[model samples]
Target: MRARTWRRIPPAARRLLAAASAVAAMALLAACGSDGDSASGGTAAVEPVTVGLASGGSRQDGSWTQAWYEGSQTAQAELGDTVKVTFVDETNSVDAYDKSAASFLSGGGDTWIFATAEVPQLVDKFAKQFPDSMVCGVEAPRESYAANICTLLPRFEQGTFLAGFLAGSMSETGHVGVVGAFDFPILTAELEGFVLGARYANPDIKISRTYIQSFSDPAKGRAAALAQMSQGADILFSGVDQATQGIYQAARTAPGTYVIPQYFDSWEQAPDVVLTSVIYNLQGVSQEMIRLAASGELANQHYEFDLKNDGVGKLAPFHELDSQVSDDVKSRLAEVEAQVISGEILVPGPDVLGTTGAGSKLDLATIKAE
Candidate 1:
C-alpha cells in the first residue's frame, strides 16, 4: 500500500457527525476491484493482498479508529485490485480483539492491522497462534514489542506542546484547561508537553486538567470542561477521543472561549472557536505499514512519525482566527518545529517526568501541571 494525492475531507467524528456514517457503511463491506493490470506493469497477475484491521472502535469514532479505517481506504485505492481490505469493528475489548483476529486469520487473511492498544496484549500470543501473520499496534511506540509484533505512533507531545503554547500565548486569563479521557502514557506526554509549552510562552500560565475516564461519555466530558471553565480557563485542549466533542459543545455556550483539537483537523467543528489542531497522517502511516508488510520488512520495527518525518502534522490553519494570530506567534511555532526536529529542544515526556498516574484515578499535579 502507498499514499497518493487525495482531497482532504472533514471527519465523521464518531457519534458527533452523520457524514462519518457513510465512511463506516462503505468500509464495512468495502472491496477493491482490480483495474485488470498490475501497478508494476508486469504481464503476470498481481498477488492477492488482504489487509485486516481489528479496530478498537467503530470507524465513525473520529479519532484513532477513524484514522485506521481511512488507511484501509487509502490502501484499497493505492494497492488497487490486488488488495482486499477487511475490517472487524469493536475490537476494544480483549475478548473481541482475540476473537476477531482469530476469525480474520482463520479465513486466510495473514497481514493484520492491530489498531488497538489491546492488540499489543495479544501480539505474542496471536503471533504464536497465527505465527506467519504480522500484528501492528497503533497509539504507542512498538519499538519494544516482540520481533514479530511491531508498533507505530507519533510523538504526539510535540504537537501538544505547540497547542499549549498557542493557548498560553492567546489566553487573556493566562489559564487553560485540558479535558482528557483515559490517561495513557501518550496522553500523559501530551499533558506534560502542553504545560511545558504554555509556561514557555507565559511563565505565569496556570493549567488545570480534568479527566472523565471513559472515551465515550460526552456528558462526563462536558462536566469536566465546565469544571475547568468555572475555574477560569479560556482555552481548552481535548485529549479524549470522540467524547471530546462534548467539550466542544460546552465551549459553544461560553462566548469568546477558544478550542484546540488533536488527532484530526477539526476546524469544521468550530471554525470560530478553534485555535488550531495537532494533526496526524493516519493514512500515510497505514499506507507505509502495508507497503512494508507487502514486502515482508515490517517485523521488529518501532516506527515513529513526527514533525520531522511529515508523519505528524503541525498546527492546522486558524480559519476564522487567521488575522487574530500574530505573525510573531507563527514564527515562534516554526522555530519550535525546527528545534524539535533538530534535537535542540527536548520536550519532557512522562518517562522523563516519572509519573504513573492517569485519569480521575490519579494525582492532578503528578505531571507538574499547575
Candidate 2:
C-alpha cells in the first residue's frame, strides 16, 4: 500500500518510539486467539509485527516490485492482524530510499524489506544505523553476516536459462533477444544463463542483449526491443520491471514474436504472445521472512532459494503458447531442468557473472549475432 505520511523525526525520538513499540508489542503477546492448540496446550495469539517494504518501482509494475508486493500481501493475508506491512514505491534513488527508511523507522517498524536489487548497500547502511531493527535486502550481490541484517537471494538464473531454452527452440529466425533494466550483477548472471541455455539448445543461435538503464522507462524499453527485432530477433526475454509493458507492445506488433518475463507469471498481460514466465517464489520467501521475524528466529544470515529447495526460481506453465512447442522440445527441457537440479549442469552465479557497472559483463562478441 502507499505510504502516505513521511514524518521526518529525529533519530533519538525514533529510537525511543521504536523501543516503546517493542514493549507494547510484547504486551500484546498475552492476547488470546481462537487458533489450534499450541505447544503450551492453550490458546496463543501471534506476535504483533510491523514490516516496512520499499521497492525501486511501482508496486503494481507486474514484474520485480509487483512480485515482492504480492508476496508481502500474501503474508499479511495469512497472518491477519498479527503482521502489518506498509510500503513505499518508486524509490529509485539513494535519497528516496533513505527517506523511505526514515519514514518506516518513525512509524516504529520492526522489520525492513528492501525489495529491489539497487538498494542492498543502502540496506546495509540502514542495518548498521539501526541495530535493533531487522533489515533484509533481496537479491543482494553477495551474502553478508552483519548484525541485524539478512539477505535473501533466489537462484533466478535457473528459470532464465530454462526460458532461454524455450526461446531457442521456438525461434524461427535463429535470433533471440534480452532486454534488462540494468547491468547489475544478479541480472547479468540471469541473462548469461539465458544465453548459455540458448546456446545449448541451438549452438548457432544468435542472442542479442541490451539494458535500458531503468526499470520504469517504457519508451526506452520499447525502442530497445524494436532494435533487437530489427536484427531478426523473434523471441525476447524481458528482464526489466514495468518497462515490460513496452516490450509486450513491441511483441504484439511483430506477428511471430513472443516474450518471456521474469519475477512474475505474466501470461495474462499478453496472452497471445507470451510463451512462459520465469517465476521467482517471492511469495514464499517473503512469507518465510515474516514468519521468522514473528517467531523471533530471524538472524543475520543469507537465505537462498533455489531449485534444490523447490523454493525459488522456476518456469511458469506455457499458457496459450503450449501448443506451439514441440513434444521433443518439452521433453528436452524437462531433461535439462533435471540436470540443473542434479548439479550436472551448473549455471554460473553472480561471482562469475561480475557485478553492476556501466555495461553488461557478458562478452557479446564471443557469440555471433545475425
Candidate 3:
C-alpha cells in the first residue's frame, strides 16, 4: 500500500524527499532501459515528474507568495508533461514551516521545492534529513547543507534605492514615507537603501517611515500610509505585501500624492500617482533552477540575483509626469544605476541605520562585514 502517514509532515520537507526520490527514480528507470532501445518493447515510457512548492502563506496573498506562484506556473508550463506542480502553504507560523515541508517530501514529489527565508532553520534541518532532495530557499543564505540545497536572494536594496530617487524627484512637499511589512533584517535593509537614496538626490528631503508588522493587513497599511500623508508626505513607498494596495487606494483620494508598489506591477491602481515599482523576477529564476535539477546539474550553493542578472530591479513607465522629470535628472539616475551594477556604488548595509552613515555616505565597515 502507498504510505499515507507522511502527510503529517510539513509540505516543504515532503517536497525535499519527493524531489530526491524522483531523481533516483529517473536514474533507475533510465538504467533499466538500454540507450538505443527499450528493454521490454520498442517504445520508451517517460514518467511525469512531480514538483512541490511550500510557501510561508497562501498562494493568493498577492505579494511574495503570489510571485512564487507565478514562477511555479512558469516551470510547469516549460516542463509540460514532464512535471506536475503541487503547493503546500505554511500559513505564516513556525510549526507550519516544518509540517508543510515534511508533508511535501512525503507526498512523492519528484523535484523543485521553494521556501521563504523566514524559516532558515527548518530548511537546514530538512536538507540534512533528505540529502538527495533539491531545495531552494528564497531571500536567505544557505549554509552547511547537502549538495541539493540552494538559495534565491534578490538585490532588493538596489531597487529600493531607485524607488527612493523617484520618490524624491516626484515629491513636491520635500517629504516622503515608507510603509514596511515588518522590521526584519531584510526589510530594514530595503528601508535603509530607500532613505539613503532619497537623501542623496535631495538633501532637504524628510522621510517618515513606519512598519505595519503584518504583510497581509490592508487596514493597518492604509492607516500607516494615511498617517504619513497627513504629516506632509507627498510620495509613499510600500514594503508591505498586499497592504500596498491599501496605500494606493488612499493616494487616489488625495491629489498630488504618489505610491510605489512592491513585487509585481501595481500600475493599474493609481496610474497618475504611482511613480514606479520594484519588481522581482522570480519566474525566470524558478525556471532556471528547475531545469538545472532535471538535467542533474543542480549545484549546492547560494545564488543571489540582482541588477546584474536582472533578477530584481525597478519598473516605471514614466506615465503622466514623465515630462516633469528633466533630461539631466534622468541622465544622473542612469549614471547611478551603472555605478551600482558595476560595483562603484555600494548600497549601505543594515548597521548604518539611524546614524550619520544613513545618508549619502556609506560605512565601509558595515559593507565589508556583509
In model 1, residue pairs whose N, Cα or C atoms come closer than 3 Å (at least 3 residues apart or on different chains), thus clashing, are 14-60, 14-62, 34-81, 207-370
lDDT of 3 at 92: 77
Q: lDDT for model 1, on a 0 to 1 scale?
A: 0.72
Q: Give per-residue CA lDDT, model 1, range 250-363, as digits (tens).
A: 888888788887877888876877778887777677777776776666776677777778647478889888888889888887776777667676665445421332222223
Q: Is candidate 1 or candidate 2 better by lDDT?
A: 2
Where model 1 places Cα greater than 4 Å from the true spot, the runs are: 1-46, 139-145, 348-350, 353-370
Q: Which order, best to worst by TM-score? A: 2, 1, 3
- Model 3, 1-370: lDDT tens per residue? 2467688778999999999999999998877665545344335566556667777666776556777777878887888877777767645787876777777776645554655656666656777777667766764553464776777667777878877877776678999888887666667777767877787678688989888888777889889989999999988988877677788878877887888876766666667766767776755655666666665566777777787776576555667767766787787788877767777767753444423235445533333222
- What is candidate 2's lDDT per residue for 1-370, written digit by digit as tens? 2223214666787789889999888767644431323344433565478888887777887777777778788888887887787868788897898899987976667889887667777877888788889888866444338778888878887778778888888789999998987787788878877877777688688878888988778899899999999999999988887788899899889898998888888999889988899888877777787777766788888877888785466889988988898999999999978877877777666666544321233443342223
How accurate locally is residue 248 in candidate 3, as Cα lDDT from 0 to 100? 80
lDDT of 3 at 218: 81
For each candidate, give its TM-score against the true structure: 0.79, 0.80, 0.77
Candidate 2, residue 134: lDDT: 89
Candidate-wise lDDT, in order: 0.72, 0.78, 0.71
The best candidate in terms of lDDT: 2
